[model samples]
Every structure is written in structure tokens, then in C-alpha cells.
Target: MKSAFAAALAGAALVLAGPALAADPTGLWQTSTRSGQVEITKCGPDLCGRLVSSEGLKADPALKDVNNANPRLRDRALKGLTILTGFSGGPDAWTGGSIYNAEDGKTYSGTLTLDGTDTLKVKGCVIVPLCKTQTWTRLR
Candidate 1:
């Protein structure tokens, strides 16, 4: 009876911990700004995101990375850029990443977390507690 009860308790614990353990931030997500979509994938043990598509580029086929700070990279295309990198964390939240904003050509400290099954809260901070967050939706 003791062994059976212990097995049942372990099973219950697994079931209860399932949701918190299942935060898979992989696949493509549409940014809250509606400017583009990012494909988040596992980069070894960490997570990384790349800009897969952009509305501005879609609107104009001849679009270039004219806003980049680097003059040499100004002629590069923005569609396939890896804007987010170096993220590391668990299923609940990922931190220690940088998200590059092409508009201003600046990279900010980034943290990513799931806000349910379909929404992701992507926070970019200039400093701790001084940040801006955008809710990104999972793409089908």
C-alpha cells in the first residue's frame, strides 16, 4: 500500500508541474508592432531568434538596411537578420539576451517569457526596471 501511494503521489506531482515545464518558445512568432515575424529556435542549450520576415520589406522589394549604424552594413537586407541572440534560461523565462532594433540600430537587453499558449512577452530594457515589453503572438 505504501509503494502504491508513493507512485500515485509522484504521478500527481508530474501532472501538476507539467504546465510550468512546457514553455516551449520555439517556432515563428509575430511581433506586437506588426512589423515582422521572428523564428525562435534552440541554439544548443539556449534560445535564439531571427527575423524571418518584415512588413517594410514586403511593402518594398528594394528595401535595404539603410538604418544600420555600420555604414558597411547599410546595404544589407533586413529580412533575414538575426536580431535576438545569447538567450539562456528555463521554460518559464529566458534572459541575458540582446534584441537589435533595426529602426534605431540599437540592441537592448532582452528577456522572453510565455504569456499563455499563444502570446509571448518580449521585454527590452535599457536598464533594470526601465523597460518596454511587447506581446508577440505565436504564428500558425
Candidate 2:
């Protein structure tokens, strides 16, 4: 009877610990180009990343999104821009999201994959033939 109870407890422990042991990509990450840092976090039931800092932002604290196609949004600041939006899934991969590029003032369908413990693969696509992938490293 004791052995059966021990087995059940062990099974329960494994079930409870499964999600925590999964690959998690939530943290501050440095871009492959070494131009900016994005901080990923939970947004409602999904994930989102914001541009916390960038080389341009560091150079001129008052940097604006001048290249934005929308003239109204051109004056918006880039420092707190929501670059990654409404990403779903986790552990190893995340998809069904959009990535905003301030440089071109464009948004692309994107995915975030946890490549390793300290590496993340960010992919953005306008279409299958027009996809771009960048490897970002964890900063914290």
C-alpha cells in the first residue's frame, strides 16, 4: 500500500513540475544586430516584447518614430514601442504574432523560438519567400 501511494505522489509531482521545467523565453534579450534590447513578458494570455532601449534611443533620448508611414504616429517615441505583439504558445516555440520594425515602420508576421537556454530565434515574414530570421541572446 505504501509503495502504491509513493508512486502516485511521484506521478503527481512530475505533472506539477512539467510546465516549470519547460523552455521559457521571458526575459530581456539583445537583438542580433546589437542595436536594441527587447523585454518579453506575459500580455494577458499571450506574450509581448517592448523596445526598452536602442542605440538610437541612447544617442538621442528624444528619438521619434519619424519613419512611420502614419504621419500621426511619426511623432511617437521608440523607447517604449511594443515591437512584439500578441504572441501565443510557449516552452519551446511561440507563433501567431506580429513584429513591428521601427526602421522601416512596418509590421510582419512573426514567431519566437527558444533555441537554447540563452538563445532565442526571432523570425518575421511578410510572406514565405520574404522571411527573415535573427538570433537574439538573453541579457538577463
Task: Name the best candidate (by lDDT).
Answer: 2
Clashing pairs for predicted structure model 1, backbone only: none
Candidate 2, residue 19: how far the Cα is off, in Å: 7.2
List, residue by residue over 1-140, the lDDT tens digit for candidate 1.
99999999999999988786558888899997846899999888888888888778788756677888888988887777888898998677899999989888878999998977678899999898999999999995
lDDT for each residue of candidate 2 in 4-69, tens digit (9 for 90 to 100): 999999999998887665477889999987479999989999999999988898998788999887
In the order shown, the candidates' Cα RMSDs to the true structure are 3.5, 3.1
TM, every model: 0.81, 0.84
Q: Tell me the whole-model lDDT of each prediction, alpha carbons only.
A: 0.86, 0.90
Q: In candidate 1, where is summed lDDT lowest over 10 consecutive residues?
A: 56-65
Once fitted onto the true fold, the runs of candidate 1 whose alpha carbons sit more than 4 angstroms away are 1-21
Model 2: lDDT of residue 31:
96
